[model samples]
Target: MVVEQFLTYLQHEKRYSSHTIQSYKIDLTQFGDFILKTFELSLTEVKYVHVRDFMVTLMDHEVSANSVGRKLSTLRSFYKFLLRENIITASPMALVKAPKVPKKLPVFIEDTKLDLLLDSEELFDDSFPSVRDKLIIETLFGTGMRLAELLALKDADVNFYDSTIRVMGKRSKERIIPIGKGLAEQLKNYISLKTLQNFHNKTTGLIVTDKGADAYPGFIRGIVQRYLAFISTQDKKSPHVLRHSYATSLLNRGADLNAIKELLGHASLAATQVYTHNSVERLKTIYKQAHPKA
Candidate 1:
């Protein structure tokens, strides 16, 4: 009953995305099932030893440390919720340490290849879907929006007068991102054409399927991958890679880190700093090109 209450809190109060809430639910349910079967204890009866035993069992089953750590995190959140509700006297998940995950630079596609992909008219056909597909690639690379954010975009969210797009991001936080002249033009053209194709349906969603239905996750993923393959050999070739390229390009183009953080909708500077790798050389180039004092 309390677990369900926690889920409700995540949905209504926290405004976590459904996918994220589902992950939390799965992790908590797995732990609950383990406790019930192994120790014959309900979640309220769970203690530090029980938590440790669960972690050991997970590890013994060859579950990655990352997964085990996430499960512990779920428990930590659950116990903290219980404590706040006065359902528990003390928290047991505090003692568990998160496993160290290896740090890796974000994988990004080269700018030159993306340039060729978008500019090469021969690569894309003249059909509306083809044009729509090209716009998708540009939108992802031009805007650092995550795939879900892009799919959820509504026609009303695009403000042509101000050259900005409003994005609803994690936790339902809304942020405004400015678009370039070129991208703005592309969006205008795509909307006109998509509207004609979708029975005047394009006004409902910024991006839509062939039948004019709102775009879904798999449709966007496949479209991004299909077009990205033309230009990038990177193993990733996902919308997020385009997002990485967008951030990396801006940082290289003399944009400030905080500005980029706002553009990417990152909640903190630490999250944006990951894009700063190999910045000095790019900064030097941008400085020489544009800095008056240089």
Candidate 2:
């Protein structure tokens, strides 16, 4: 019951996305099961030592540090909630520390490679599916929206005359992302094709499957991976990479950091600041190649 109450708080008060709330639920449930079985205690009764033992069990099972860290984070939030609600007199997670995850720079396809892929007329045919796929790629790179945000996009979200799209971001925050003329035209064409589909019960979501069903997560991921493979050899070809590419591209082109943060709908500037490292790396590479001093 406490878990359900915490989840309700997350959903209504915190406005966490459903997907995120689900993850939190899974994490809490896993911890609850662990504590119940191992320590003969419910979630609120677990102490710091019990949490540490759980961490040891996870490590013993060879779970990746990143995953173990996430589980710990979930416990931290749950315990915090319990404390706030007076369900617990003290917090056990106050003593726990998350593992330090390795810092890897965000990966992005070069702008030239992306341009080559998007501009190649032979790659995207005139058919509805083909055109629709192209628009999906364009929208991801053009707007820097997350996959969930893209899927949540509705027909009413686009303003053709204003060249803007309002996307629902993390915590149900809504922000308007400006679109380029080329992408706007592409969207218009895709909508025209979608309108001609024979499905009687059409979905209002902006992007859909060839069968006119609203696009799901796997469907969108497959589209991004399939298209990105032609241009990038990086192991990660997910939609988030396009989001990174969009941010890096803007930062490289001299867009202000705060502006990039707003466009990407980041909670803070620190998330947007990572793109600056990519730009600095580029400058270093250029200097190495062109400078006279050996």
> Against the true structure, what is each candidate's TM-score?
0.91, 0.97
Stretches off by above 4 angstroms in model 1 are: 199-203, 278-294
**CA deviation > 4 Å runs, candidate 2:** 198-200
Q: Any idea what lDDT model 1 has?
A: 0.87
How many Å off is the CA of 118 in candidate 2?
A: 0.6
- The per-candidate count of clashes, in order, stands at 0, 0
lDDT of each: 0.87, 0.91
The total of clashing pairs for model 1 equals 0
Worst 10 residues of 2 by lDDT: 193-202
Q: After aligning candidate 1 to the native by TM-score, how far in Å is the CA of 279 from where it should be? A: 3.4
Cα miss at 46, model 1 (Å)? 1.4
> Residue-wise lDDT of candidate 1 within 1-294, one digit each (tens)?
989999998899888999889999999899999999999999988888999899889889988877887888888988999999999899887687766766778888878999999998787887778878988999899989999899889878999999999999999989998999999998888888876775454447788877777888899999988888887777898889999999999988789999999889899999999988846656788899999999
Please give, for residues 172-290, the per-residue lDDT of candidate 2 as tens digits: 88899999999999988888878878532577899899899989999999998998989888899999999999999999999999999999999999988888989999999999999
